[model samples]
Target: MPAVTEPKLIAGNANLSLAKAIARRMSMHRGMSVSLVEARVERFNDQEIFVEVFENVRGEDMYIIQSTSNPANDNLMELLIMTDALRRSSASRITAVIPYFGYARQDRRAKARTPITAKLVANMIAEAGVDRVLTLDLHAAQIQGFFDIPVDNLYASPVFALDIEHQFRGQMNDLMVVSPDVGGVARARELAKRINAPLAIVDKRREKAGEIAGMTVIGDVRGHKCIIVDDICDTAGTLCKAAETLMEAGATEVHSYITHGVLSGPAVERVQNSVMKSLVITDSIEATEKVKAAGNIRIVPTAPMFAQAILNIWGGMSVSSLFETDTLVPIYEGLYQRS
Candidate 1:
């Protein structure tokens, strides 16, 4: 039998902490020894980006872990340059591991003369010589179709469902999973099914970007502790409004679990003043200081999930099983059995 070689991990500056965490998990995996391939990503005096891989990756599989977050353009350019560098270094496979794929929200043209930026971003990654893409909870799942290369769209529902089970445990009946809008109903329904909770939708009309014109609850949330589920929370205008609407509909308490917490502009301030009991988000995108200081906000690390997915992909194992959603009965049974 031929000896197997470990895939080289590369980190970009988009989210160093997350990248490091994934690296640590890789190193800790039994029978697997992995390390990040050293690389220098800097800029010239004229503000041009430069990337140089120090290690020889000839014919080796390499995965570049980056999140196109806050500085979207800079981080995106860095990823593309890093991919091109790895390609030039003769890496057999270059997978762009983007935890928070920026510009994913612009997957469609909402109006005439508008650009479908997500498709363009996908094209850029492919043109940069990437063989595959691995990302989490894209705003639009169809963005995967935009990429010519193989793209794995991982879901955060498993993590959130496990947490929900732990938090609500015996009180699952009191919980109601909610979709902030019709578009997110599918996501919220999956979460609701996992927790064995009823589902509700907040029918909202968007008159302008980053703002909601009006919102109406589509189902009864009266006396239920509602949990709104969504893929992203950018300005937080919609989430805050949905929480308020739920409260007005007699929901006992409103909580939320979002995959990506962009939290741009006045998001933190709005979340602070919202009627939500708490807002839990995944650390797909690095959290800002304001998000860190917010009393009502909590961040859950998603590094373990990503780490497992990366390992599975490198080992040629199935990644779909990693996203299997949990149900209340099984969770309860396992918990009791463990005790």
Candidate 2:
């Protein structure tokens, strides 16, 4: 095989806007002029995904930017088929850059006769001929083990921390990070430590997924500006309820910083009517019009960080350095200041 020179970005329909943003950000980095590969990812009359690479990809480093988000099955299939196409085209390396990896919440079998869909998705991606995987804020960190290829699981905490600082700059003294459930204590605690704030947990009894039976605050949130941290926000039922519970526990104001805004059924409506002051999410999953229209929802762009990660991977640099708070704070601060 010949030496791979530059990274070629290929995007599926899952999140085209984010892909473009990543390309644009990459171009801005130290005169590295990167652009998306000329490819067609369309569908046939039977809804079968068809992918064609217009440019020569032989021996090139290819990064497929596709999130397995809404219409999960279709987007996932597009990724698989695109990987197969690239492998057949003799690409030297193929990396799947999935910003919002769907089926991540199903990492384990919670009940008998159920399958671990997360592992299944990982297996499918590997079998499709991807040499590496880059994804953000997986629902369960252990999902990395499911992949045979090298996996880089990036966190949104550094990005979220900077936004929280900018938004609650003056009120940091009275800020508290709240985990919506017991399972998310580590995530919330990390953010709390980043901002030098206290941490709290919302102990909830989930009778089933998306349904909260009851919830109680594990720590005192009295007069504090509470921020809930979680990975995915699907229906927003639990998020809204957690905000209300925090208020009842004497919280002055409530906000949320979730990684993936998988705002499915009634999520926007619920957020609009909830007691939360704001719900900040990343551009991992493309925002819907309803989400864009929501008064309390804000989206922090993750493009610069991802673009840097791609560059580091291509240059054989340290990707873990991007995870440090000091490293990303300036990048995010500059991004927010520009906008």
| Deviation from native of the Cα of residue 43 in model 2, angstroms | 0.9
lDDT of 2 at 151: 96
What is candidate 1's lDDT per residue for 233-328, written digit by digit as tens? 998988899999999999999999999999999999999999998999998998988999999999877777778788788888878877775322
Model 1 regions lying over 4 Å from their true place: 1-3, 31-33, 208-210, 325-339
Backbone clash total for model 1 is: 0
Q: Please, what is the TM-score per model?
A: 0.94, 0.96
lDDT of 2 by residue, 1-339 (tens): 323498889999999999999999888874877889999999999988899999999999999999999899999999999999999999999999999999998999888999999999999999999999999999989999999899998999988887877777677898999999889999988888888999999999878775678999999999999999999999999899999999999999999999999999999999999999899999999999989999999999999899999988998888899888778866555554312
Q: Largest TM-score belongs to which candidate?
A: 2
